[model samples]
Target: MISLNSITRNLDLHAQGNWLPIVVSLVLFLYALFMPKKELSWRDLYITFGIIGYFAWISDSVLGKMLDLVDFGNPKITGIGEFLSYSLIPSSLAVIFLNYLKKTNKWILTILFIIISTLIEWGMRKVGYMKVHGWSFFISIPLYFVVFSFLLPIHRKIIKCRD
Candidate 1:
C-alpha cells in the first residue's frame, strides 16, 4: 500500500495542476458578475484586451521563452494557466479598476494593485503554481509600474474619445 504521505503529496500536486486554475477562474467570474456596474464600452473592452495581450506576450514569450526567468509548474491546461493568472485575471481587474476608481485615487489604487498582485504571485510560488529560476518578485514591481504607466494614457485616451 502507498504511504499516506505519498498519497497526500500526489493529491496536492494534482490539485495544483488541475484544480487551482479552475478555482481561481471561477472566483474571477463570480467577482465580475457582482462588481458594481460600469458601462463596459467597446473602448474599455479594447483596453482590457490590450492588457491581456501585452501580459501574455511578456510572460509566455518574453519572460518564459526569451529570458528564462521563470517556469510554470504543473499546469494541466497545456500551459494556459500562465496566461490565466498573468493575463486574464489582471486584465479583468484592470477593467473594473478603470471603471470604478475615482481619478484622485488613481495613484493609491495603483499602489494597492501592485501590492495585491505581488502578494498573490508570492502565494502562487508558495502553493507550487509558479516556479522561478532567476526571477524575483521585486523585479515585477517596476515592470508592472511601467506597463500600467504606458497603458494608463492609452486607456485614458480611449475613454476620452468614447465619452
Candidate 2:
C-alpha cells in the first residue's frame, strides 16, 4: 500500500527526471545500430522515434493544453516541454515494441499495455510519484483503446505493404 504523500514526494523529486528516458533511448539506439537490418533498421528506428515523439508532443502538450487537460505550473511553452519530456518513455517503448517485436495484434497489446500502464500510474499516483490533475483510468482507458485500435490496422497495412 502506497501513500499519497510519498507519491507526491517522489514525483516532486523526479519532476524533471531524465535518466530513465535517456537510458532507455540509449539502449534502443544501440539495439537499432547492431540489430540485423531486417529486424529493424536505423532509418526505421529514427522514423519511429520521430513519429511517436511528435504525436506525444501534440497529444499531451498541444492538445492537452487546448483541452485544459493539464498545466505545468509555469509558462505554457514550458508546459509543452515538460509534457514532451515526461511522455518520452512510454512513447519510445511503444515504438520499440511495435517495430522490433513486430506484433500486429495491437488491440490486444494495447489493452494489456493500458491495463498495466494504468495500474502503474495509479500506484505512482498513490505513492506521490505522479499527480492526476484531471484524468483517471476511466478517461485514459477508453482513449488508449481508440487510439491503439485505430493504429492496429494501419500498422498491419504498413507491414504488409513493406513485404
Candidate 3:
C-alpha cells in the first residue's frame, strides 16, 4: 500500500541533496558546452562526454548497487538526483579535464583533478547527496586518481582512431 504522496514526501525537495544535483548538472553542462575548446574538437568533446558519462554510470552501478560500497541518495530508490550526480558532472569533468590537460603537466594536473574531485565528493557527502558504506573516504582518493588518469589515455586513443 505505497501511496504517491509517501514517495513524494520521501524526496525532500527542499533538501540540498534533492536540488543541488540538478543545479550542478545544469551548470556543469553549460560550462562544458561553452568552455574554451582550444585542445579538443567537436568529436572529441562528444565522444569524451559519452564515454565518461557511461563510465561514471557503470562504475556507480557496480560499486554502489552491485557491490554495495556506497549509496547515492536513498538506498531504497534511485532518482534524478543520482542520475545527475553520477552522469553529467563526471562527463563535464572529463571535458574540462581534457581541455586543461593539454596545457598543463600531465601528472600534476591529474593529481590536482583527483584532489578536486575528492573534495567535491566530500562536499556532496556533507550535503547529504551520498552515503558511503563498507568503505572509507580515503578510498575515493585512489579511485579519483584512476578515473582522472584514464581521461588522457582514452582521449588520446580516440584521437588516434580519428587521425
Candidate 4:
C-alpha cells in the first residue's frame, strides 16, 4: 500500500530527487523557444511573466509555505530537479498556455484547462512529485479556474493594447 509518507519520503519527490518532470520541463521550454510566436510586445511579455509569477507564488510561497497545502518536490530550489520541476516547468506551461490559447469557447476552454491541470497534478501526486495536504485534486479544478480567470484576461488586454 502507498501511504503519503512513503510517497513523499521514499519516492524522493520532495527529498531525494525526481528526473522525469525536470527533463520534461526542459524539453517543453526548448520547444516553446522554437514554437511560432506572434508579434508580442513588452507589455505582453510582462503580463505573461506576471501570470507566471502568480502561479509560482500561489503554489510555492503561499500554499507551500503559508498554508502547508503542498510540496513541490522540495521545499526549496536546491537542485536542477526541484528548480525545473517546481518553478520553470509551471512558468513555461503558463507562458505557452496563456500566450497561445484562444478564447474561442471561453468557459469550455477554461474548464478544459482546469481538467488538464487537475489530472496532471493528480499524476504527479501519485508519483510523489506533488503532495497535497488538507486538499484534494478536485479542489485544483476551481483553483485553475481562478488562475486562468486572470491569465486569459491579462493576455487579451496585453494583445489588445499592442494592437
Worst 10 residues of 2 by lDDT: 72-81
Candidate 3, clashing residue pairs?
none
Q: Give all TM-scores, in the order shown.
A: 0.72, 0.58, 0.83, 0.69
Q: Per-residue lDDT of 60-105 in model 1, one digit per residue for the tens?
A: 6677767777766543233545546665666666665566556677
Candidate 2 segments exceeding 4 Å error: 1-39, 71-87, 100-108, 152-163
The residue-by-residue lDDT of candidate 2 on 73-152, one tens digit each, is 23233432254344554555555455544456555667776675566445445544334567667887786666555663
The Cα error of candidate 2 at residue 72, in Å, is 6.1
Per-candidate Cα RMSD to the true structure, in Å, reads: 6.1, 8.3, 3.0, 7.1
lDDT for model 4 = 0.63
- Looking at model 3, which ten-residue stretch has the lowest summed lDDT? 7-16
The residue-by-residue lDDT of candidate 3 on 1-163, one tens digit each, is: 9988776756544445667678778888899899988677788889888888888889887999899988877776777787788778898877887877754577887988887777777777888877888867678787778777875657656674844
RMSD in angstroms between candidate 3 and the native structure over all alpha carbons: 3.0
User: lDDT-based ranking, best first?
Assistant: 3, 1, 4, 2
Off by over 4 Å in 4: 1-17, 38-43, 74-79, 158-163
Candidate 1 stretches with Cα past 4 Å from truth are 1-18, 39-43, 75-77
C-alpha lDDT of all candidate models, in order: 0.64, 0.53, 0.77, 0.63
